[model samples]
Target: MSTSAQGPTSDESLTPVRWGVLGASNFALTVSLPGMKRGPLTQLAALASRDIGKARDAARSLGIPKAYGSYDELLDDPEIDAVYNPLPNHLHVTWTARAARAGKHVLCEKPIALSAKDAEALVDVQRETGKLIAEAFMIRNHPQWQQARDWVRGGQIGDLVSVQAAFSYFNRDATNIRNKKEVGGGALYDIGCYAVNTSRFLFGREPVRAIALVERDPEFGTDRVTSGLVDYGGAHLTFTCSTQAVAYQRVNALGTRGRLEIEIPFNAPADRPCKVFLDDGSTLNCSSARVTSFPTVDQYHLQSEAFSRAIRTGSPVENSIEVAVDNMRVIDALFRSVESGRWERL
Candidate 1:
């Protein structure tokens, strides 16, 4: 629950978290690292990559102070406060647990673990270690989602009746991990998780049942596309995700009294516009009215800031580890439904 009254704290006095990057993933380079640079709540202290040359290059390119050739060495740095885990899907659990055991707070990449059981284990480790753990689903911290959530709860769209969403991108590169099932690469775990998370966030309720059809390639051994219907209370959510398709992502809501739609809603800037249509057909579109910040803002930065706040001040995070675990449970059930060709209970 974000409060408008909690206006941006003065930067000079806020505690800055020292962050270490565990991998030089594309997402880390393009989004997360830049966001961290822009944030007053964090400092990029170190970066680690298996390849020393790549690690050195990333460190030089990003202007980070230290580069380690091993992830364990980065973890052992006494000055580091937290880690941003951007490893492969299969590695999320093992590395997150190791970070926890090292007494380091973690903001791991989404789908924190491949299975619900593993997700729960990660949460349990967080509890035992008394460290803040957040999955790097930065969209949850973005203003588009925050405003949309407020509208859904405030009845701006009246009674929420249905949701429709899609997220996809072309991924023909066979060498990419997304094409490997053994490593937890697939459309549902990759982009489809966005649709699922967005739908659940807007509804603020868990689905009771799910049905899905997944298309798999024998060579890749992973589902290239997955479509599903999730029943949340009386509401319905229809979603599709694909790695074989061209890029397209959107989340739309149909309500009893009106409709609400967001273009690039999940990954939009904090100042991005969100549109609403009333039952009478009146339309209004405006930027995230809550944030009066200048220029554009990074959701990753905001998320990291919030997580740091949680660590230092004991403030609760918007997306708790419990929430991530529950979400993974829902996703696990969806996968089960696909396997059984039957409705799966969540």
Candidate 2:
């Protein structure tokens, strides 16, 4: 496996982290493999799918060295240093544990598990296996989000009071894993996790309580539309996510004296530079806005680099299992709030 051109390609002594992907899912094939290939620390090593032909085709497309007809085969390979688990939400914890027990570091996609309780099991898995396991929240590593947080902490937005975000996309296909109720399909789990995760990121604390209104799809039996308010006691984070609406995403942090906005918060494009706006409370229409644009970056590439670096150095992963479990607690509370019709205390 050769190093990619995106990072410090001049470092000849650095041994690349051998990575194996759990499944040949679309996100893994298109987004993850290509993105990781762009980073020098990663070596596109092995890919696995239930079908050998599909796995081989995917491997050939991305130039990954090995293809396995079963996930266990790739996990059993000693050369693979880490595993990227882009499996469905329900399978996240199961496969993540398997990879860890196989003595491989794992990066599992979010929402990390079906429930907070289910996600908590990985805490024991990591400690017992002595292997690092992390949740894949690529946005946390993005420059735009980091800058936004830095500005907030620096008082650029004085006394951050509230965060507002919305993420939605129309997908009602019953066959899609995202719409399948049995497999943990819903707005809250799919897209709303970003809203919940980002709000907590800016707040620098877990929400104290949560209240929500969730509307389920009649046919899919999944939460199609969910609006939740997470109270951090003094500050609040509010967001709405929908699986049956037009595709859109935006995040704004409003402080006592000013506001900051992320134009394309979630799903920021890799080809173009992204922008964030800062405004004094002099106007509401963003007329008094000061704009800052970030250079072109693939957050996924940065994410892969960070994960592999952690594995190589024996350091902590960026989003540890503990962090993922805390996020899950917030999501669980919001769901409880939907049922109780009252604020659920976290």
Candidate 3:
């Protein structure tokens, strides 16, 4: 799949992908657009929105060269080589397919689709277009995560046992996309995915089953809080994500001999060094702790660079659509478990 957008000609191998964003969502303006500018093989070339005024405003503020009144117009631009879809969660599949069919590689936002079945629809399109399509799970590109995985694999924690995680924030604004159920709003789809993705990342295996306790917002009809347990053979991962709660996040990975605590597990601050603590559990305190820090970096920039490199050099993607599908399957099972009041096999 990575080779679908085969490496460019010899002379074009080092060329940056002229990235055109589909919308000027707040996340795009405040985070992705700026980070995308720093990529080794990415360019903030254009931005488009259904509203011409919105697109032009975003383009001017971000110094993007072209602004389009419609997504189709930007897709038709000959100089553009890739597209980033930060549209609402519900639109990820439709827009990604459109971008691919228009002869452009695509990097779409997380929760690539509302369901595993919806995500599967892209497989045929990807194969048919021979285009590189990747979900934007920027965390996978962070060096801290890589280092954490290393410690797990290298036995720094001595045989991974379980991963305990929690991510939450108070957001009740009915107007916010994260609160709109029809467009795929909810704690599970928005943040619980990190728990599933990273546990799978560290376990290096799929979970055999899953179960969850979900609490929905009466007004929004969306899961405001969700806690799920996944069984990876003999190992386990317990995580809770919330859309309405005190703002906080952390992840702890425990093993037979030691444990690792990721301080800023999900929303890693880009302006400062990221740290992870290792504890041997000898004293049950800080005395047995070791600290590891990674220099300041924006995960989004790294994500863009990796995808662009894969496009320009025929390299592998850090996380592909197949990975997204597996993740969705776990999430799908969790949702079913809520209804059935029992564990659902993955």
Candidate 4:
């Protein structure tokens, strides 16, 4: 709760921001943790989990200097300037609020809350503490997405007409957290959020209404597949996501004069180059499409660096709590539409 508008320390202005992880989730281990270690703007200071042994083992294996038995201990560490919350969807808001109250900036995992109302509560916490809290939407930091957004905004794709996207992965494990409804598990809450977020990001606005159809798994009580549509005035966004299908993802944007396609839309590879395909209406064959390949870049590193810069300079982040809330509002409407069998206004 140190709400003082103090600037970064003189040394910290030249050094990396000391960062801690709230949990030893696989994503933190494989993606965010490595990103922190590699990024010049962040220091992998510590890690904490409910199980002390696991925390210690992970810290040792990851070369982190400190390990805590509890998340509170990590948050209370005066040396840690920020904490990454890779907890479950339901725990995102709680731990993020705690981190902010402990005078630490937060880069929380996506779908920052299960609902719009909960997202609003987190926004309130940010307002009260004046801390730099951002939902960890790493796609926003990817060069592919940045270029796509720029092209769309720069009128390279002409007037936007529609967006079509799909994301799926086969995960049949009954005990997986994504299969548990109580923890905010579902196809929509998992991969579908990315599709929705991408649409909103490229469109640069929220939908006016939404409709969705979902099929749930009987044993897991989680949506196995879902298809949704969002009305954005003259333009529309359509997406389908599934947990029971083959792993695949693609996003295409259609406009009056041309189209934009992302070959590796959501799960971008960090070690290999990724391409964005653009096609002007002048050509009739697939060979007419132009390809732009981005070099090997770790988006998680970019995200961490962006958050660190915001904390160091008191600047705004790309994925603000308000953006999360708006995304959740569209998600809430989609769920309502699925239940009511009609379009739900946002």
lDDT of each: 0.81, 0.89, 0.89, 0.88
Model 3: runs farther than 4 Å from truth?
1-13
Name the better of 1 and 2 by TM-score.
2
Residue 270 lDDT in candidate 1: 45
Candidate 3, residues 206-304: lDDT per residue as tens digits? Answer: 999999999999999999999999999899999999999999999999999999988998788879888888889887757778877777888887788
Candidate 1: stretches off by over 4 Å = 1-12, 269-295
Off by over 4 Å in 2: 1-13
Task: Residues 186-207, candidate 4: write the lDDT tens digits.
Answer: 9999989998899999999888
TM-score, one value per model: 0.91, 0.96, 0.95, 0.95
Task: Judge candidate 2 at residue 173 and give its lDDT.
Answer: 88
Error of 1 at 90 (Å): 0.5
Per-residue lDDT tens digits of candidate 2, residues 200-280?
888888889999999999999999999999999899998999999999999999998889899999888888888888889
Give candidate 3's TM-score. 0.95
List, in order, the clash count of every candidate structure.
Answer: 0, 0, 0, 0
Candidate 3: pairs in clash = none
